[model samples]
Target: MIRLEALAKRFPPERQALQGIDLEIENNAWVLISGGSGCGKTTLLHLIMGLDQPSQGKVFLHHQHLGRLSAQARARLRANIGLIFQEPHLLQRRTLWENVAFPLELAGQFGRALRQRALESLEQLGLGARATALPAQLSSTERQLACVARALITGPSLILADEPLERLDPQNAALVTDLLRARHRAGGLTIVQTCSESPATLPDATARYTLCAGRLVPSGLLER
Candidate 1:
């Protein structure tokens, strides 16, 4: 579960990005940080992922204060949280499988075990056929899938995706969304995704909240 308490971030002349965000995300939940551009949706993700520290509030992951962690501790904590950025964010020089395996290696798993795990991840993401393909050669949707596979291959507890289907055509987008829902259904998986317009991704979400004017507004009930 994730909790945000009095979360406020201000950039002096740039205006306030978030103001007094108080919310709770339960385990086994899929919630969209619904919002328009510049509404601090992405900023909220950063706070959750511990990529950026809050200006005057606290972010708690499973009841542990994220702000209390050191830099190295923060990295360790992020290993337990998978993130899919708005962009594919893959390395051009690396092959598709290599990019997916990067996180595993960074986590200290290696050798044939690493290769097997990476291959399995690609297989699950339906990118097994393109495992050897380089990032520059893959299509936007393909790269996006690879990025998602990279995140899941590590088996993180939570998934935080920013504009997950930003560039895909309907078909590819649906495919990815379906896969995400399947994972959510499997349990104890907390997924926080942001999309400009809502897509019927998961049926058993915990709740849905909208971000506007730097505040979180309740949208509706989310359940099966």
Candidate 2:
């Protein structure tokens, strides 16, 4: 479960990114956080992922406090959280295999074990044939698929994506969307996604929220 109670992230006098937002998302629930650019949608994800700090209020993951956790504890918390962005953001110098191995390597798993896990992720993304290819060699869509593969390789309990469909055709978009929905259906991950205005269909999001003027408001199911 993920809960944001009176959550706020203020920048300065000129910019109040998020203003006391309140939300509740149950386990295995798929949610969409829709908003205009810089409405604090991505900030919400960052705070949840422990990438940024909240100016005030509280963020809870399975009823665990986020702000008070130590750095090492936060790292452990992050291990169970996956994040995908607008682009793949792979290393230009590394091959697909090496890029996918990054997270596992960071976690201290190494050798053939790390290679095996990375290979499995590539296979899942249907990019195993291009495991030796560098990021420079892939199309934008393929790069994004690699990002998805890396995020899911750890079998995370929660997945957060920021504008996950920025550059893809309808066919490829649907394929990736279906992939996310399938993960949601497996009944363990709490998936939260942020997008500007989606193409009409989204992963079976159980709840939806709209962000405007720094406030996060529920949009509900029938609103779809």
Candidate 3:
């Protein structure tokens, strides 16, 4: 579903975030990428999502080159991807339902269909009763669960999450992990980057890789 070929990203003042990174994620596969801080995990994800352009090389999403696509085309392509960040990044002014429905609303879904889709996603995460609450009103775990619900509401074919479970308690972290695994099993390509090598996140992964000094290297085979 996604491929990165010799991808490299360099920031101003000669800071290289990634160098010679090649990756491939097939449909329905769960890939785990682990790395320390400043190791370019988030930068790599941004390149794959077309949020950032690589200084060298190419990123292909569903066979289309991201760097070569027009802005409108990129936006359209991005609709097929769901991204969950370390922080939920929910809007303070928007209620939980509104935040989860934001993506569908952008796609022009409205009324019953939009509401139902958002509600269904929240229900899946056990957040149905909190739909009317604001982000600040919810607990940290609830906020993260709400983010997962928002990401899945679009039924995206690919999911790119960066340290999604970093701030959750053990119970909440397990819940999020299970949700991600279930989504991948349902045919979505899921790639997650975590700083720590937690068994909850690694056991079910089809493959694993590590980022070190801006390079992508095989970590080892996962048990699943």
Evaluated with lDDT, which candidate comes out highest?
Answer: 1
Q: Pick the candidate with the highest TM-score.
A: 1
Instruction: Quickly count the clashes in candidate 1.
Output: 0
Compared with the true structure, what per-residue lDDT tens digits does model 3 show for residues 65-136?
999998889988877678787777899999999999998987888898888888888988888999999999
Provide the lowest-lDDT 10-residue window in model 2.
197-206
TM-score of each: 0.92, 0.88, 0.91
The better candidate by lDDT, 1 or 2, is 1
The residue-by-residue lDDT of candidate 2 on 1-224, one tens digit each, is 88888988888776889888888888878888898877888888888877788898998877888888987888888776787977679988989988888777777888998888888888876788999899999998889888888888777888888887777667767777877878777778888888887335653777788999999877767322
lDDT of 2: 0.82
Q: Model 1, 4-60: lDDT tens per residue?
A: 999998877868999999989888878876888888888889888898989978999
Off by over 4 Å in 2: 222-224
Candidate 3: which stretches are off by over 4 Å? 198-201
lDDT of 1 at 70: 91
Clashes of each: 0, 0, 0
Worst 10-residue lDDT window, candidate 1: 197-206
Deviating ranges (above 4 Å) for candidate 1 = none
